[model samples]
Target: MGREIYFGQQELTLKLTGITRFFAIRRKVTMPYSTIKEVLVSDFEAPKWMIRAPGTSIAPLNIYEGSFNYGDEWYFLSFERKEPVVIITLEGHSKYRYVVFAMDNPTKTAAEIRRHLHEVV
Candidate 1:
C-alpha cells in the first residue's frame, strides 16, 4: 500500500496505510511545520547498514517501512520501490530526525511542504 501526506493548520502528517501500517508499526506521524528544517525530492536508497529498531524491511524488493536507526540519528521511512521520494528534515522533533517517504508526486509534495514551512515562519 501507499502512504498519504496531509498538511494541517500547524503540522504535517504522514499516514501509513494497509500492510504498511502493520509493518511500520505506526499509523501516522505528525510534526509541526515549525520543526521542518528542509524538504527535498530525490532518489533515495536506504543504507543497508542501518538497524531496524521496530520496522519491516525487504531488501530484495526494496520495501522498507517503519523506524530505523543509523548511528545516533532516527529515521522514519516508507517506500515500496526505489524511486524518487520526499525527504523531510526536522529539528526539535522528539523521535525522528528525518522522515523519508514515497509519494505519487514527490516534487509537488515537497513544494507543498515548503510552502507550509514558509507560512509557519
Candidate 2:
C-alpha cells in the first residue's frame, strides 16, 4: 500500500498507504515559507538532552538525515522538503531528549537552501 507523493509546478496530492507521518506539505493552502525557512536555517543540531534511541532507526524516504545532534537531544528522522527539513521522534517525545529539528541542507548554505526551496516548479 505504499505509493509515491508528487509535488510539481502547481499541483500536490497524496495517495494513502497504511502509514505515513508528517512529511511533505501540500500546496493546497498558501504556506508561510518564511517561517519554514527560518526554522530550517538554524535548528538541526543536537539539543541539550541527547540520549540513545529506544529502537533501531529507519531510513528516510529521501535525501534526509535519520538522526541529528542538536545540543542535548536526538531526533529520529528529518524530512527534507522544498522549504525545510523537519525532524521527527516518537509520538510523546516532543520535548527533552526527543524532538524535531527543522533545518535546511547541511552541506549547502542558507542562501543556497533558500534558492533551492524557491525554485520554479
Candidate 3:
C-alpha cells in the first residue's frame, strides 16, 4: 500500500492504500492533536525479534507498515526510510503507544506537530 499523512488544525490523518483502488488495503488513522504527547525525529530499525502480524512491507519501495510490540509497549510504525521519520508518542492510546512515519522534512514536521499540540493546550 501507499501512504499519505496530513496534518490539520485539530487532527492528523494517516492514509494508506494498496496498489489499485480495487485491490487496496486502505487504512485511515485519525489522531487528535491533544492525543500527541511527544514528537521526536529518530533513526529506527525494526528489532531482530520484531514481527508485523497484520502488516505490509515493500522493501523495494522502502515501505514498512505494521505493529511492533516490546514487553509492555506496542508501536504502530508506517515508515519509508527514504528519509528520516518523526516518532509521535500518544496519551491514552490503547492500541499502540507510538506512531512512526517518514516525512520530507522531519525536523520541520516535528516542530509543526508540537505547535499543534501546544495550540490544543
Task: Give the per-residue lDDT digits (tens) of candidate 3, residues 32-51.
Answer: 87677888998876555555
Tens digit of per-residue lDDT, candidate 2, span 1-121: 1223334444222232222222311111122232232323434433334333432223342323234445665444333333443322232333323323233243243454345447732
Q: Compose the digit string of candidate 1's lDDT tens values, residues 1-121.
A: 4688888888999998888899999999998887888999999888889999899999999988999999889999999998999999999998999999998899998998888778777
Query: Which regions in candidate 3 have their CA more than 4 angstroms from the true location?
Result: 8-10, 17-26, 57-63
Worst 10 residues of 3 by lDDT: 17-26
Which of the two, 1 or 3, has more TM-score? 1
lDDT, candidates in the order shown: 0.90, 0.33, 0.69
Ranked candidates, highest lDDT first:
1, 3, 2
Candidate that scores best on TM-score: 1
Error of 2 at 70 (Å): 10
| Candidate 2 similarity to native, TM-score | 0.24
| Residue pairs that clash (backbone atoms under 3 angstroms), model 3 | none
